[model samples]
Target: MLHPEIQAKARAELEGVIGLDDNGHIPRLPDFEDRPKTPYLEYILLETTRWAPLSPLGVPHASTNADEYKGYYIPAGATVFANAYAMSRDERYYSSPEEFNPDRYIPVSEGGRGEPHPEGPFGFGRRVCPGQHLAMAGVWICIATLLATMELKCPVDEEGKELRPTVGFSDGLSGVPDAFGCRMVVREEAMELLGL
Candidate 1:
């Protein structure tokens, strides 16, 4: 809802892939096999993780041996937290870190910036989230499904102006965005396809 253009682009890809029935209704839901055909979806997911990491401070790790960086010294055992949030917004990589654009992941040959996929969202090294694969798959399908059928956008006020949300996130170990209002109207075509 915060980014309607992104949603529209994703939906367009889905529509091209899924197409419509002879009756001019959606024919089927997106499947795993659509991965290749819907590359934009992957970019969107990647941008989502990079834009707003779920774990701002990734899972803490304990050093088995002493380590030092610069002039700082560490004991044999110390707890360390990777600042995933800061890494996400690093200008060195992302052109406009504040903007929620997914096209950055596309390769230079594909006319995109070819930015590298982000790291540290799941974790670092061997301590990486064990279920990262499952989590990503689940998230991808959920996002694809929502975009396929819904018109997600800001709600209009009495004056018919969009009520752009004041984007905010919850505090703590989690980086869940604060709740915001938006419309999620099921596309008329989708409803007709579903026989609703």
Candidate 2:
């Protein structure tokens, strides 16, 4: 909902992939099988993780031995934390870092202005979350299904002015959107497809 254009593009991809029935209803639900074929959806999921990582400060790591790098010294057994959030928005890696633009992850040859982002959302190295693959898969499926089935929009007030909630997050070990209002109306085709 924060980005209507991205949502529309995703919806178009879903319609192209899953297609519609003779009655103009979606023929079937998106599944894991469709993941590889939906590159845009993949970018959406990746951008989501990069835009707001669940663990801003990745799981801390302790150096097993003393080390020196870039003229900096590290003591043995020193606790170190990887700031994944900072890296995600680094200007060197991303243009318009503040904007949640999925096109940044798309290939330049495909009309997108940027290239695929380097991996970092899930911590680096062997210590990275073991469930990273499963997590991404789940997210992809959920996003794809949602885009294919519903229309997400920010709620409006009685005066018809759009009531966009302040984009804020909670303070804690994890970061998630603060309370906000959005309307998830099932698409007409989707409702019919679900026989509702």
Evaluated with lDDT, which candidate comes out highest? 1
Candidate 1 least-lDDT 10 residues: 187-196
For model 1, the local distance difference test gives: 0.86
**Stretches > 4 Å off in candidate 1:** none
Q: Compute the lDDT of residue 144 as modeled in candidate 2.
A: 88
Q: Write the per-residue lDDT of candidate 2 for residues 106-151, one digit (tens) a residue.
A: 7777767775474667889888889999998888888888888898
What CA root-mean-square deviation does each model show from the true structure? 1.5, 1.3
* Clash-forming residue pairs, model 1: none
Candidate that scores best on TM-score: 2
lDDT of each: 0.86, 0.84
How does each model score on TM-score? Answer: 0.93, 0.95
Error of 2 at 185 (Å): 0.6
- Show model 2 residue runs off by greater than 4 Å: none
Q: Write the per-residue lDDT of candidate 1 for residues 20-114, one digit (tens) a residue.
A: 88876778878888777988999998998898899998877888899897878877779888998889899999989989899999899988899
Please list all clashing residue pairs in model 2, or write none if there are none.
none
* Candidate 2 accuracy as TM-score: 0.95
Question: Worst 10-residue stretch by lDDT in candidate 2?
Answer: 111-120
